[model samples]
Target chain A: MKTSYHKLKNFINTPFGVILLVAAVVFGVEVLVMEFLFVFVPVIQASVPPIAFNFLDAVILTLAVSPALYFLIYQRIHADAEKLRKITESAQDAIIVMDNHGRVSFWNEAAETIFGYTKTEAIGKELHKLIAPEKSLNAFNHNFKGFQETGEGPILESVREVMALRKGGEEFPAELAVSALPINGTWHSVGIVRDITARKKRENLLRERERELTEVNEYLRNKEAKEQALLASLGEGMISTEIGGEIITINRVAEEMLGWKEAELVGKKLIEAIPAISETGNIIPPENRVCLNVTAGACVGPLTDDTSAFVKKNGESVPVAITTTPVIIGGKCSGAVIIFRDITNEKELEKTRRDLLSLASHQLRTPLSGTKWLIETLQREIHGTLTEKQGEYLTQIYKINERMTNLVHDMLGVLRMEGDINPAKIEPVSIQTLFGVITETLGNVAKEKNITLEISKTAESSIDTDSLLLRNILECLISNAINYSNEGGAVLVETKRDGADIVFSVKDSGIGIPADEQRQIFQRFYRATNAKTFDTKGTGLGLYIAATLAKKIGAKLTFESAEDAGTTFFLRLPASAK
Target chain B: MNHVLIVEDEDFLVRALKDNLVSEGHSVAVAMDGEAVFDELKKKKPNLILLDLLLPKKNGFDVLKEIRQSPEWQLIPVVILSNLGEDSEIKKALELGANDYFVKSQHPIQEVIEKVREYLEGKGSTKVGL
Candidate 1:
């Protein structure tokens, strides 16, 4: 089972056989000389002294000399040879030696097992050809040339990571180490090899994972850059403010709209940078303003109900439409973003339209007053006599003029609502004062329709409000109730405090507004569908103007109505509104 | 006859006011600008001044402010007649101490004349030329 070079060493050295030859020669020469001398000189020994001699003496001497010397030296050499053969063949790593001609001169049993080849088949074959079939010849030729010229080549160290051929023609990764030494006056290389397939596969997998991670990091960085660019390109006047109301980022539109350069305003407070004023002429500090239309607390949507006048760099005030959304991160409100547009031109145009409407309404008053005067003058002069038909025609003309005058008055209300007037015109107006005004204004209308209108209240603080506008709003609501009421139905105006807001309600037993049309009643040019069939003259602008003024003065316009259940229109004005 | 001076830029409305005041037994003198107003006042000191807000040579507020600054015309009542009935304009006119302010659209020609009569009578202007 072992490939032993000891057998070869023994055959070549012949140590034990040479020792046996010398021992045999010395034994033969001693025995022959001793016997020749005894047989040739017997007469000389007798004359010297009559000595005793026997045949047994020569036999004992030959026995003692010949076999003893041969057995002791030759047998010991054979025993030491056996031990050397076993040690050389039993190593764990594959060991093979190649002669100077690239042929395998020595192949141990371990080498045969490692290569899946028997020792007999491996020995005497070219070592490179057995391990690497295709590149073996070229590699051997190159390495042999290098060794011959430079006296050195690759030593093939232990377990090197490279492909080696199995007997089945498959290649697996292996580790190899080689050493060159002189054997019997010829140079040879002894290679020690080991398989390393599992270790190499693990290294390749680790490198691939590292590459994947690097690619993912590169992709995320690019995506974040593009998103940042998109945030910067928004067209509206975009502004981001810190929680302390300091401006952080101002977009191009915002910079132009506020008339401030980016460098001039970034760290300044919004109020300091751009002092804003309400339509009512009150200055609103930026920190107190609420963000509108924010959804899910992220503050990424449009603002609502944002009307304020921004102070320009030159101290001129320009109206703007502003929208603000809160910027929230990690479930907390961090800051807010505001978008706005300059609306000065549009506001001016709207003011002009309202001015024209006001002028037209006033124009109607002159003719109306003249006609009333003329009719009164005629009645006073002709008290003595008049035909029934003539009186009826006069009465009809009187009624028509009255209607035209009322329409003109409604138009005037709308015009006045459009004007920019501070509602700080409010003063400590008593509920009694409100009652006196409303009843007096509606007195004539109620008389014609034979309806009773009145007011009731139970409030201590004289409700601070613009008496004139409040009178107009209440009169509209009460008169509408009276006009739309059946004959003999009652109308009542009442006021009281409902928490922080003053509650003013007008209740009337009348043709109530339909439920579905209630939402649209406060809209401009919106008339109730049921009211259209009642032959009542309503300009539809009265309630619209009333509601608008109510809102401007911080009042809520609400109502409850049911068919034939009577209607109640309530105005909840905050105490601060006063 | 009670004398009323009408300082207005609108020719038709000025003429109509003049004719109406003249027919009602009042002497009417008209000026179209601030310069003309002073010239007319030199000829005959009017009992009342009805000044329009808009004029060619000067605006009504400026004329009023100038007339008010003068010691000679200090006692004369100047009523502002304007088509710009804005709240701020009205406030400014009142603050300037005009006797009254009226929008042209708010009154008829006859009613405006009647208002002038009521104002002049309330002042008790009995002296003829002064």
Candidate 2:
């Protein structure tokens, strides 16, 4: 949909185009009519006026009209020259017209302004001599001779640039276009000149800017490629995530660490990609996620506190020391980088250390036991009967020997717990039956002190516990009670169901631990001053070993006592379901 | 008197055990390691064997494996007396056809001798992998 206004705009944009088209059509029609007239006149000449008469008539007519017609044509030519002069004077480009004799006929105002010559000084003068450089004057004259013959030379037929000199003898760049016109049977050449010095300067500046831009682009590309190569070649696993904890980039080591391809984990939330589970096989709480902490702008170092393992895509756990740092950009946290390494080999080496310890302990025990047996068999008179004083000395030897044995046993037991061995086999266990076995095992020892061991239970139900470990726990508690109790004192073993747990208490009427020493009772080899004095023969590892074994079996062992008051040690273990 | 074979590496322990076993009225033979034990077994068959686990040459498990695999020696009673008291080790020894298992440090000479006498009388029994 073109409006009338748009049509007028098109016509104005190409103002000279329509005029040239109309001139071209009129010229074509005139040439055709001339050809037709020439042919018809030749054929009809006999019937028409005689050739000589016609020639005389034409000559007379031409002679009559010559002066008047010449005046009229001269007036018209002068008017057209005036019109061309006005047009050329207002144009931005310089216009110079020269006759075939190489003499300048006309110079427009622009030509005068450009060449520093007035029209009076330029007209009727040689054009080459006025404007051409001294060095180009000979070539310009040579080309001018050829141009007159054919009107087909470089300067006459087409646009071209030539060395041009100004009035001050200075040379500058210029754009020149030349065309030939036949006016009154002579070839006249016109040149349009545009000074291009400012255009050339601007073009050079643009080229310099483009070169600098290209070099800067190359430098940035190389820097980015070097950084990427460095990240890829690292041995420590590196994962860079967005500020929201979504994974954005992963290095080669990170792919191996997480057991996933980069495409599988990138753009996905880190927590979802590598689900960090605690050693207890439960998901770590969101607050504990190192990735999330870094995303919140907190710096984190390698975490060595709680054991955390990552769940791989294959559902296997890989222990790791995960640390993260925020990738800060302009004082704002844009993302975070997580670096980690697999700890499997470290874990294996730790196990090897434990196994080594066990091996050394095993070797140490054999000789220690041999010494014990040697001392015992000699004292018992199995090899020889001991005298009364020898018996007294042997008693001391037996006590010391027993203490060493207990210490070794306790040390080994603690090591086993540290090494995570001897797992509990949970089953229904009867407190009544355990009490029976304890009595049968330690009854004679209790009898030596006239201690009465009694058992009372409100209910008889088995608990979920390792039978042997529970037996050892009871044996430690009741024996400890009996040994610490006064002669003729009663030691009570009580058991009852308390909600989800079974509470078993070994209450002893004994010389109790001091209030000051109660706090230190659970520590290994710790002894109360009074107990150390009262019983010259105790390892003081009874409670420590009991407490440790209880923890190993997921039980709670607690106690309450006062100085010289009866102490009660309670063992609460989770009861089995019906 | 019943004949007993004692396979132990500890010099002091071997002396003490020999003394105790001699006093208990049982004839005793000694093997310093698993290889010696096998060689001694081929030379002379004892009524019972007290095999220590940690050996200098072949380990006790390999020796036990050999004993259980052989037709003539499979039925002979083997009592493992080891200082390595870990349950997994004990389980492995029993699974390899041990008649009984004992930690030397945990047992008195009298208890060990009593065990040796019981096995010598052909009364020894194992609860599993018999």
Candidate 3:
């Protein structure tokens, strides 16, 4: 019978059972009514005999039927109640029912899984006693009061990182989402909790990486500051320019050297900053802007070039030796970097070296000159008459002394020319007169070699220069041409004007300078290999002096030479002299 | 005859220079030190003063400076004769109103004489070598 009661409870919970019960009750009532009518009608006919048995009885039976209908409605109400109880117990979510007191009335499978408690153990216990840790047991009272007054509980619906105690008394980080439900006038909170320890660990690692990156950035910033400070404090002059020769930056040393404030020089073009001029009073273009003759038509300016001098803020010129290199970025000439030192001391040292050389040369030439004079005097019998053999001896002495004198003079010329001092007196000199005097002095040497020395004037010219120095330069060139010329070979000295310059050339139809030696022939103490082979008596300083002199005059000493094809040494002098 | 004064600390060179000048027909007086130059100058007016740059007691430049400051001796032409071939010193001397500058190493004794002769005979005498 108890089992039957349970089975009935189970059937009442089903949706189909409700339909079947209603049909059965209706059919049973119909049969019962039929039976009642049969019994009632026989009795009525006997008791009343006529009058058609019954309107009154019929009314009384209808009243009785209404009472039975009321009983049937009550039974349906009880059955619906049983179904609700069964559904509540079988639900997937925990549907706990508690009375006014905080007690666990029910527990479902999900509640057991989440809390690690069985229904038998959890039911009838206070909800806080089973779920809350000892520390949080008191919190439930406060939360319960809030629930009673508000008809709504403090339901945590957010995913919160908190520690939850398992049935085994172990605590773990968990995400708890809690919501309240009202059933039968009581409120209960259902919490969905999840562990999030791994997520927390990943967040911590990302935070650490950000800190490390910030530290690296700080370190780099400090390092950059230190390097920038070091560069700013460097003692030497530092200047950087753009490819167009515009000054980009300069340091304090450069400002002082230029005699300008830092503001004045930066961003100014190099040429505009200093309009430098050569010795002949002609402006020399900036080195970057200079073009070689062969490439003049197609050449563009270089980003970097070197120069020997610069003009200062006060318009005074100073000697400087600069080395410039291109600041290339991505294979393009972005700008230039120039490192220069004030070469005033270097210039002085150079001058001293030259002076010493000249002094030594002078000392040597003094003796040679004296020897020559004595030899000549003896040869001419100025001191006394000479015998034929004595005259021959005197002639040999004169020849040797003359050679020594020429070598010493050439050396002296080189030494003096190399000095930093400009030796020109810069007086107006007629080219014809100067040429006449020079050739006249060298004519005897040419005669001895039987070389024809011809001077031809392509243009009449005048130059303001030191006549004595000019004479020395001309003598050296003419002598070089004559000495190298073979017997009866013609040596031509030509003068012509090209644009604003006066050009002088000594052309010889004899042993020419070799191509290899020509480039270095102008170096101090450097002699052409061919010249050394042909004339062992010549000092190597002649061409060096000529080049120096040419530089002093703001002229270019250029030459065209070939082995055994003869050579032409040309001096391009400016029309104006300083 | 041009009257010349030779101021040199080197007695041997001064003697030789004086003798050479004397033989070339010039009246010559000599001062071995800068102090004696002023005193000698007052006694006899010279046509030219061949001044040495280095001297005892007072340098030649100072002596020249003193002479230039003085009214009586300022008209006498002074020529700087020195072995100090430095450009700055020469330029300073000239700018300080020295009449002429010549480096002894560059010119022989004969060339010196010729230069002196030419200067004495030219219009520059009044301003320089007179």
| Best model number under lDDT | 2
Clash pairs of candidate 2?
none
- A309 Cα displacement, candidate 3 (Å): 17
Off by over 4 Å in 1: A1-223, A239-340, A347-453, A462-471, A482-491, A509-536, A548-567, A576-578, B1-130
Writing each residue's lDDT as its tens digit, candidate 2 over B1-130 gives 7778889898878877788888888888999988998778887888888888889998999999999999988988998988887767888999888988877776667777787888777676663621
Query: What is the per-candidate TM-score for chain B?
Result: 0.89, 0.93, 0.89
Better of 1 and 3 by TM-score: 1
Tell me the TM-score of each prediction against the true structure.
Answer: 0.52, 0.53, 0.45
Which residue pairs clash in candidate 1? A156-A177, A156-A178, A157-A176, A157-A177, A159-A175, A160-A175, A160-A176, A299-A326
True contacts kept of each: 0.04, 0.44, 0.00
Docking class of 2: acceptable
Ranking by DockQ: 2, 1, 3
Candidate 3, clashing residue pairs?
A156-A178, B47-B130
lDDT per residue (tens digit) for residues A70-124 in model 3: 4576577779967876775565544545544677766666567656888898888
RMSD of 2: 16.0
Q: How good is the docking of model 1, by CAPRI class?
A: incorrect
DockQ of 3: 0.05
User: What fraction of the true Cα-Cα contacts (under 8 Å, chains A to B) does candidate 2 also have?
Assistant: 0.44
- Predicted structure 1: clash tally: 8
> What's the lDDT for residue A563 in model 3?
83
